[model samples]
Target: MTAGRAAMLLALSWNMKMEEEIKKILDNKPNLRYVVTEVGGKASEEFRGKIIKASMNAAINKNIIGKNAYESHALLHALSEAKAGVTINSSMSVSFAMKVAIVRSDHWIAVAMFGQSAFHPMTNHERGGFGIMHI
Candidate 1:
């Protein structure tokens, strides 16, 4: 097997929990906050945007630029609080997200996954959500 493939496998097999993931990041850099979103699509964006806005910053502005590179201005907008922010959207599914999260050893990665009971009506597999159907 390829060395890179072996490394990826090792990372995926590493044991870690949800809260622990964030905590690990926070532990390393207490000055930074995390915005956990799914890999792509509108549903994931809207779902995770809520967490970013309500929990991270209330003032969602137009300063966010480009097709990607979101949260560049958002971390700055928070004002006199956190030093920096990072958004992790490595995967759309819970399992894949966890795998990606584990894959990265130096930096923390995260994904917003809804539980089976607490489903968001706005979230659908077509729109990049961890739903019953896959696109």
Candidate 2:
């Protein structure tokens, strides 16, 4: 295999292992809400946009963003980052918003959310071209 392919395989393996480890940890603590979504076979702007919109809507519908002007501004910034295809890792407990982590490989981009149960609905929405797993 080419070096690039080898590296991609390594990353995929590592991510799968990490996901399993995270699942085990979350399983131990059932009280904490955890939602994971994966999009297989490369990342696209459309998929990213959908995730951004869904996440933003979830935050807004949960009253996490609008309650405080500062929080709203922060979320807007996060949305911009998402739009730019930047990875997100925010974990503010008071906002009722979900933290997003994007893991990418040569063939896929996986988005994981950790927060309220409301975020769970955002998973498994990519219609086709991407394989989604929610756990």
Candidate 3:
């Protein structure tokens, strides 16, 4: 892998470990708040956006920026929060999102992503998502 790719992987791994540590520390505390949504497709954006607004009571704007840095933003959001829940489209995105969430925060659980998951392995690495499901 190129140096840049290696660096990104290293950073991701580090973030995952840090999230775990943070969760362990916060588990002792009481009353933590969090939310989760599956972030994909055109309809998904609307649903998740509504959820965010309802949960936070604030309007959060999202722009289509040619898919430049999804993982980074997701990871940052995960790390900044105490607990998080994630909903994924299928087994492929589930796995990818789980990895992202794990790197962001330890207190995360992916809804599902085990059976009949077929993804374009090459593209998955860069986009951080799975392609399709084949049963």
Residue pairs with backbone overlap in model 1: none
What does each candidate score in C-alpha RMSD?
13.3, 15.1, 14.1
The residue-by-residue lDDT of candidate 2 on 1-135, one tens digit each, is 222222222223335677566546544643332233332222345545655666556555644344566554555554454333322331221122234443222222233343332224454221111121211
| Pick by TM-score: 2 or 3, better one | 2
Candidate 1 stretches greater than 4 Å from native: 1-16, 35-123, 126-135
Top candidate (lDDT): 2
lDDT accuracy of residue 18 in candidate 2: 73
Q: Tens-digit lDDT track for model 3 on 1-135?
A: 222222123223335476455445444434321122222322244534533333222112221111335533443343323112233443323223332212112222111111111244454432232111110
Q: Which stretches of candidate 2 lie over 4 Å from their true place?
A: 1-42, 67-70, 79-135
Residues 18-135, candidate 1, lDDT per residue (tens digit)? 4465446444744323332222222245434443444332222221122233432423233111111122332333221212111111222222232221124444221111111000
Candidate with maximal TM-score = 2
Using TM-score, rank the candidates from best to worst: 2, 3, 1
Give the lowest summed-lDDT range of ten residues in model 2: 126-135
lDDT of each: 0.27, 0.37, 0.28
